[model samples]
Target chain A: MIVTVTPNAALDVTYTVDSLVPDAVHRARDVRRRAGGKGVNVARVLHALGADVRAVVTAGGATGAEFAADLGAAGLPADLVPIDGETRRTTTVLSAVDGSVTLLNEPGPELSAAEWALLAERVRRREPEVLVCSGSLPPGAPPDGYARLLAGRTSVLDTSGAALLPGLAGRPAVVKPNLEELREVTGLDDPIAAAAELRKAGAGAVVVSLGADGLLAVTAAGTWHATPSKVLTGNSTGAGDAVVAALALGLCRREPWPEILRRAVALSGAAVLGPLAGDVDLAHYHRELAAVRVRPEGES
Target chain B: MIVTVTPNAALDVTYTVDSLVPDAVHRARDVRRRAGGKGVNVARVLHALGADVRAVVTAGGATGAEFAADLGAAGLPADLVPIDGETRRTTTVLSAVDGSVTLLNEPGPELSAAEWALLAERVRRREPEVLVCSGSLPPGAPPDGYARLLAGRTSVLDTSGAALLPGLAGRPAVVKPNLEELREVTGLDDPIAAAAELRKAGAGAVVVSLGADGLLAVTAAGTWHATPSKVLTGNSTGAGDAVVAALALGLCRREPWPEILRRAVALSGAAVLGPLAGDVDLAHYHRELAAVRVRPEGES
Candidate 1:
């Protein structure tokens, strides 16, 4: 079973408006709420692909209750650690006229030392074949939170900034960071150089997601770049999580690095075709998988 | 004793950000939540002024619980009618850069016919000396909901559009509409003619709020206009609610038309000087009260 840990879970609220005019009042035409976070999205993708997965999340207050209810309604299994502070919410306003999206993210609640320990204990109790740690560390949480959780476990780490560097200490099997995150953490503009830096820092393998450009991986076996034949257009919100899900599955199956990279690229492209994050069109995935081209760094 | 009814109450949330840019992600610097609705604001203002006031509102779901907790924390008296639908939320975004404000309002939960009946029953049981109905009616609620509640009760009515015209059938002691609402409901640009139209429709008196210009009142005693001596520069969000609060108090105390109009204008100006709705700078209110000018309509 794969276990996903979300340190800062959120209740994602989406508001659809006719148009968004700055400094004006808008009446939302529709409102939707769901349980969302990096790890939650990753676990959701894995589950949707028929993988055995469980999510471990910290929750508190009313928003937390709603998040838990949504997760259950979605039939996703999770272990929830109770906290005193309320869980934060992320608001996305979609403008129907211009199709513009505006996001407002609330910095999640601070976790006390005791709360952090409780969360770690919960994840430890749910021993799994693979552990995936994703998302930002909440205020008051130790920066090395993922490092501590990844200790002695086969894990995939996905995060950015301060949380990103400390997590590398965990020596995760795979560390996935988008281009922006890669540059911010490594201070390198070149994706190849940034991935190399993370691998040297302690990552067993560093996977970099290049948005529509596809996935680049620096592994002990070799460096490889994978891309789809044609770019797919859709919402890219959960594309990275899809990549993470594919990588986790590949690790479990002990697939070769090239095969893993190809699957990751195909799955991510499929995710882009879906309206919401953590969802993918299976038909699109299969079609893209055949079109995905994976080659060693020097082969191109 | 005054009873204020909010058919569609909301949990008002304010997010302060460095700046508001369209279609961009924002991390809120600060967040604030409060129980709010027009009637709730009126009740809060009256309570702050040491008046005997109670608010009647419908609430449900997690947001409702928070709203109730806020009201309790404020030490305000209230009657909460439970419903199956969740209370709505209104989000206000404040940009620190240019001090611009953006508002997003969620349509409140739809109340069932039974729920509306229950709300009316609760208000009837209270038998308030002055009944104050404010804000929009929720979906599934009668457009003439205020009319039914105002029947045979000394009251002040404040609403717009369909809700406004039907409410006049109840013959509320006073009907207050701002310039925009007067035009929208009566289809006349002239406030005097529009106010007259409403009075003819069964309203005992029509009081029109003219923003910085103060208030215009047409009553059986006489036609009068009241204005604050000078414009107070500040947030005007709750100024109308302040006017309603003063009107309720004036009715309870049996103040004359001109005296009531003077107090309404002064309180509204003071509310503008405060940061939030339902709050007035007491010092400013006192100072403005003395400077408020009230004169018969025909007099210069």
Candidate 2:
């Protein structure tokens, strides 16, 4: 079973209005809420694909309760670690007219050292065949929190900045970073050199997401570039998580490296076609898979 | 004891940000929450003034649970009626640099027919000396809901539009309508004639609130105008609720028309000086009371 840990899980709320007028009163036409975080999105997508998945999350206070309740209502399994601090809520205002989305993200509640230890222990006990540690570290947590979770597991790490540096040393099976994140961590303008440098730091493989340009997969076996036939334009919030889910599934099923990259690219494209985070149409995923083009680049 | 009925209660959330740019991402510096609605605010202010008060509110689902928990945390007494619909949450984004507050209000949940009767039954059981029915009606509720609640009681009705028209026929002890609401309901530009017309429709008295200019109280006994020495402004969201609270107290105390108007005007100004809804500084109230000006505006 796939197990994911979202230490900074959130209750994501989206308010859809006719149009958003700044510095004025806005009455929302529709409001949608979901249990969210990077790892949570991965688990949700995996579950949508009919895979057995469990999400280990830290939740507290009223917002935390709402998050847990939302997960239950959606039929997503979660092992929640109760804390004293209230969980944060991320709000997105979507304009129904033009489809412009504005986000308001709150800094997550700080976790006590003891609470961090408790969360680490819970993730370890889950015994994931393919573990996914995702999202930023909450305040008061050490940067190595995700690194510790990746210790004796074949994990996919999706995080950036302070959290990514220490986590790279733990040798995760895959590290997914966007173009900007790759530049920030390695301080290198060249994407190929940055991925190679990240691999040298002990990441098993590096998947560099290039947005509309597709993905660059660097592994010890070989390097390959994969791209969809055409760009799909829509909400891109959960595209990375969908990619991670495909990679984890391929790793668990012992699929070929080239096939894994193809599936990941297809799933990422399919996720973009959907509206909400973690929402992907399986039919769209299969259709995109046939149109994906994968070519092996020169050996690393 | 003053009893307030907030048919549409809310979980009020405030986010303080450095600056809000239009259609761009904002990272909030602080977040605050409370249980709120017109009647709830009136009850809170009355409680802060050491008046015996009880608030009857409708709450449901996860948001409702949080609203009730917040009320309990604040030590505010409330009688909550459980319903199937989830209570709404109102968000206010306050700019730390300029003190600009942008409000986003959700249309409240639709109530079942049985839930409406339950709420009416609960309010009647409270045996309030001065019943206060305030705020908008939830979806699926009859416009005459407040009129039914004001039956066989000396009540202060504070609402607008369709709800206010039906409630005015119930002969509430006092009906408070701001300038805009008066114009919308009566379609009269003249405040004096509009207020007089409201009285003729079976209202015991009429209190016309002219924001910044102050209040005009017209009763069968006499007519009086009351105004604070200066227009104190910070957050004016709860100023009307404060006026309703003072009016309820005065009715219970059997105060004269001029005295009641004077206290209402002072409390309204003091509420504006405070930062949040229902959070009037008693010291500010006392100071404003001394400077309040009241004059007989010729008998009606």
lDDT of each: 0.89, 0.87
Tens digits of lDDT, candidate 1, B60-106: 99999999999999999999999899999988887878776788889
lDDT of 1 by residue, A46-151 (tens): 9888999999998999999999999999999899988899999888887878766688888889999999999999888888789999988999899899999998
DockQ of 2: 0.48
lDDT string, candidate 2, A181-221, tens digits: 99999999988899999999989999999988788999988
Interface RMSD of 2: 1.6
User: In DockQ terms, which candidate is top?
Assistant: 1
Q: Could you give me the TM-score of model 1 versus the true structure?
A: 0.87
Candidate 1: where are CA atoms >4 Å away? A186-196, A204-236, A256-262, A269-275, A291-300, B178-236, B254-262, B269-276, B291-300
Q: Candidate 1, DockQ to 2 decimals? A: 0.70
lDDT of 1 at B205: 91
Could you tell me how far off, in angstroms, the CA of residue A103 lies in candidate 2 after the best superposition? 3.8
